[model samples]
Target: MAEQQTDFDVLIVGAGLSGIGMAAHLTEKCPGRSYAILERRGNLGGTWDLFRYPGVRSDSDMHTLGFDFEPWRHEKSIADAPAILDYLHRIVADRDIGPNIRFGHKVISADFDMANARWDIVAETEDGERKRLSASWLYLGSGYYDYDEPYDPGFATERFEGQIVHPQFWPEDLDHAGKKVVVIGSGATAVTVVPAMAARAAKVTMLQRTPTWMFARPAKDSIANFLRRMLPEQTAYRITRWKNMKLQSLAFKRARTKPQKMGEALHKRIEKVLGENFDAEAFTPPYDPWDQRLCLVPDNDLFEAINEGRAEIVTARIEAFEKDGVLLSNGRFLPADIIVTATGLKLCVAGKIAVSVDGEPVDFAQRFYYKGCMFSNLPNLAVVFGYLNASWTLRADLNSDYVCRVLNHMARTGADMAVPVLPHGHGLEEDDIFDFSSGYIQRSKHLMPKNATRYPWRLNQEYLVDRKRMASEPITDGILEFSRARQDQGAAPEMAAAE
Candidate 1:
């Protein structure tokens, strides 16, 4: 194995929305800092590029999903994968961040050397060549889900003779025209795929063990468009973004505080769409709204498909897969030429990259999340985990800005190392970072970092609250300790401060 060494002031992993946004922030806020982005894939646009499934689109509006610095100029707020990719491409091209990207460099592990106050990283290329690099700060923009392998529900595939497909790894050549398609699962993917496949397929059916709350809204935001026409692009974008954030926060609070009313309201909206044909029980979930994310159907496309007799929803447990279709627990058989598994994702911590401090492997589940970005007792490392209730980019933008602030503070204070130190015996009540009841969240909670009940110690779900705290909170909080390393002896600490 060949080896190479390189150094940068900061290193960003995964050139997805988070990674690209962080780099753009660096250019704007920390121009003097040297940085590079390492992407395991050959191309950019992480999730947007990876999931090629039919009707893959953002459930969240693009106004908030877009970067704080960049304005979303698209007509459709709920954008498809290609539109999202185009937005990302524009950012990369306009900001000139393309040259700094190192594609096909998959990060295997990162070790923080406390003595030197830097991170030693090991990354492997596509050809199995190992390369070594060092950076003062490591930012993990890699998403929380496992990219190599998706979650499997363990279906009996041998009994089914027809074609089966997983949305995560959708085959480009598979044809569904004039075929009967049965999609399993009731989340966002299933809702999106059923309607999309129904366009060409003879019939499409969504099979779910339980129902999910659904909300129908126009894909194009008239208010946003009107604002854009009346005001300048940036002004319009800012106004719309702030408006959406407030609405999102209010809706989330209402769902938590008064789930019954919110759930009723959502059902009523769907009832209006389906009218006499509405299946009240099939549209209602046992749990409250926002327990799992509420699926958004743009322009009532899913409901429209159902009303047109092109697509239908079947709520039942799967007994097994037969030769031609799915066998329901109720002994009902659904004929299908193609079966699509829209199962949830398999979540992983820090892109499955092994991280250690002073050669000791770090168990994230045992560590507390610091300020929603960095971890307790971990130096010069930050991870971007987005919000559960709001647009993911909302949290991503805040985290990127917070990281830039930290880096700038270090330069101004001449500190070579910074870590959020949770002293022993500190009585911070531990809390769950994610309060979601979704299968993906429930399945992967064990792999997540610890969260505290207080501010600056938890991954907060409130976007507006987080936005203010991340921007205004003092970076020199006593919990985060900063220190300088001695030049004479690499092992000697010259000075340490927790100002």
Candidate 2:
């Protein structure tokens, strides 16, 4: 029942892309600092390890998705789950990060002791054993979506006689070969699952209430492959990463500024592929391009499946799930033996960990985001919520680098606590930083932290501008206040029983 002591200088939550990347940065940039990664799951690789559905792959290219410190040697820029896991494993092994990770340790709550300037952490194992731990600083890389549950569209599954599955929890024993499979939803998951299950399933149908904008591109980056062959591994990786980042930025800008033109171009591309059988209504979304994320169909796999008549798209309202399959509002019934709900993810913030400061609960929605990593008035804490338009790791890499710089700065200045202080009467306009119409984004918009109109206070979407600003901007910009703990709080508490 005694108070737990600080166990590590930094306690990083989650062992996913962001967590591992942050640990790697710590090793390189702030070598003397001691850190530990607490992962709730048994294994690492976060999303890659969690998702077991067929044809699971990255929507973003690997050149940009891979860590900035590590060179991505994989040939396919659009990598599958296994390959991505392998890459992550290699990073852990090479960086000696495996020893620093505590698996099956789920963080339940974290309370920052303002007097001591340290965080008191409570984590529970899978078996429900609670352990106390503490750290000088906390970093949350727990990802954006809920790991325990996927978004439920409130489908009445009891009416269906056949098997039902959600892509988030794909059954290992389930077989689709020769079965009529229908995937519900038009997001990236549905797009990936339809083509993947088409080769085996007798017929794969993608059922959607509304059309989602789609873009087709080759799975392999020809330019990256060529550069890899000609140039050294590291050099090629750097060049390819830079090139892809620029291209991604340009594409997003065009989509935002010229949505009509971009939408038309996407439509034309789909028309060229689908040819005579192209359904304009099914391919064209009511909203503009990048309104929701553009579904990236690598190698035209989704289109190829549709073109081959193996998979089809049904753009209609689901009246109900009948005994055999889904009955549409238009009086059309789609027959299916197996149904996979590729319905989107349920978004979560800070891994749903209960956070507080000096017994006062921290409601992130009321606080403003500081430098897209830290929050206003939160001491010794940083959270990684990556980019929506570009690769998630792009922001992950930047945030990790920025955190490392902050950590090093703190050590140099002998400051025990650092918090972004927003004074009253500060003239700052609130802005909707997410600015996306995606269902998940819209659903969780109220849960997210506030953002200002200017730099350092807002979560900037443009990576190029962020990269320069993060690299060059001074840490002591008066906004982020740094201070030492009071001597009256007593000497540093000794280590408690920590897992």
Candidate 3:
């Protein structure tokens, strides 16, 4: 049993949204392969399990966010945390994925031994047990944010008498009822929490150093429900997903071309709904559209909260935390019983797990990402990075499918190891992967991978573009180096056996 414990054809690193979707794909597409998903937490949901703050919800539409094979039956395009978690749980139960998941296994390192053509994975269990697992392939499905350590604003929490809270670790027992709440940051998370907390709180204020782009979209998709009644469940979902995907793609392109126009349009839309009471001066941002992600408020809920006198938006910088509340740089002090720091997430590369190829440490900062999924020079490893302009699961599905395609190609060719080699950098300069100017991205740009100026080297952020390329792109484009099994174990299973 001990010897058998370490063996698997593939090892998945997280049981989050991407991990679960990948597992389902592998089960359907590669039935012969043995795989296991190791989640560091006791619960299956990664981000959903970690963040329990009020008004926690998905900014992207659920039609595109849901798994390709599974159709989301819900009406709301923007779903709350509990509904999203329930969807994940339902997928697991329906697929019988519970048996394949090993909860509480925090992976420490994965070292690839070239001679054996296998990876030795070291993981520590929650109860302090160390286990070694061996596999031919590794998949990183853990989302980018670090659960153990959230981004700290470096504010003086000690001086403040009010309850200072970070959205990542929301205290369940904290009494926030009827208190004056001041939330810092203008990102999606802050916008979401403001309206939800404002429903009960006496007053909620959103304080941001710089205002982010905010737009209001309908919470429910009436067209989707209408199509669902007329068409089959799977058919309706696919059609709606594609429709949303294309619209999102078009919007990004137009925003890039006509930033000023797009920005003005968004501002006008918000102002029209907000009426005479709206603060157009505060809502207008300095940067152009799509420079950073836009904050989405469902059904003008945030605007309604502001107009109804339950919430207010303040654009200002924080000087320091006073005894009672935050002192602004503009010589204004906002008194609050509760101060919520919804600043942003701390970006992490591949979940911050240590990885080494042979004996040399893998420096992600110096590496080039191949096809936006695997790092150049890495063998049998794939990472799922979602699009910033659209739903994350769209990219996850395509990445998983690409992995299956590569694995099947190797099986057909009787090759056991495949590595992507960068072509001497082609004298092409390295550029940043993400084009956004968000604070979290700017803070962690040094630790992330770079993209090249060439195709398959430069990552595509467009969903439709990636869909076509990832599906039809040649797997062996003279870049990936494939090898047979090490001589000691056996010759790569005979070509005839693969058939």
Which digits, one per residue and each the tens of the lDDT, describe model 3 over residues 1-499?
Answer: 1235678888999998999999888988988888889899999878878888998999998999888999988889899888888999998888778888988999989988777878889999998988999899999998888888889878777888878889998999977789999999899999999999999999999998888889899989999999999999999999998898888888889999999889889989998988897677788778888888888999999999999999999989889888888899999999999999998899898888898877667887876778888877778899987888888999899989988888888889888788777655257566667898888889998988878767677666878988898888789889777887566555442211000
Full ranking by lDDT? 1, 2, 3
Better of 2 and 3 by TM-score: 2
Tell how far residue 356 is off in model 1, in angstroms: 0.5
Candidate 3 lDDT at 26 equals 91
Tell me the spans in candidate 1 whose CA falls farther than 4 Å from its real position. 1-5, 486-499
Who is ahead in lDDT, 1 or 3? 1
Model 2 ranges with Cα > 4 A deviation: 1-6, 488-499
Q: For all the candidates, what are their Cα RMSDs to the real structure?
A: 2.7, 4.2, 4.0
Alpha carbon RMSD to native, model 2: 4.2
- Model 2, poorest ten-residue lDDT window? 490-499
Q: Write the per-residue lDDT of candidate 2 for residues 54-170, one digit (tens) a residue.
A: 999999999999998898888899999999999999999998999899889999999998788889999998999999999999999999999998888899889899999998898
What is the per-residue lDDT of model 1 for residues 1-499, given as tens digits with 9 covering 90 to 100?
1123379999999999999999999999999998899999999999999999889999999999998899999999999999999999999999889988999999999998877788999999999999999999999999989998989999887888889999989999999999999999999999999999999999999999999999999999999999999999999999999999888889999999999999889989999999987998899998999998999999999999999999999999999888999999999999999999998899999989999977888888888888789988788999999998988888889989998998999999999888888767778898877898999999999998988899887899888888888878899988788887545345653222111
Error of 1 at 69 (Å): 0.6
TM-score of 1: 0.97
Count of clashing pairs, candidate 2: 0
Task: Give me the runs in candidate 3 sitting further than 4 Å from their true place.
Answer: 1-4, 486-499
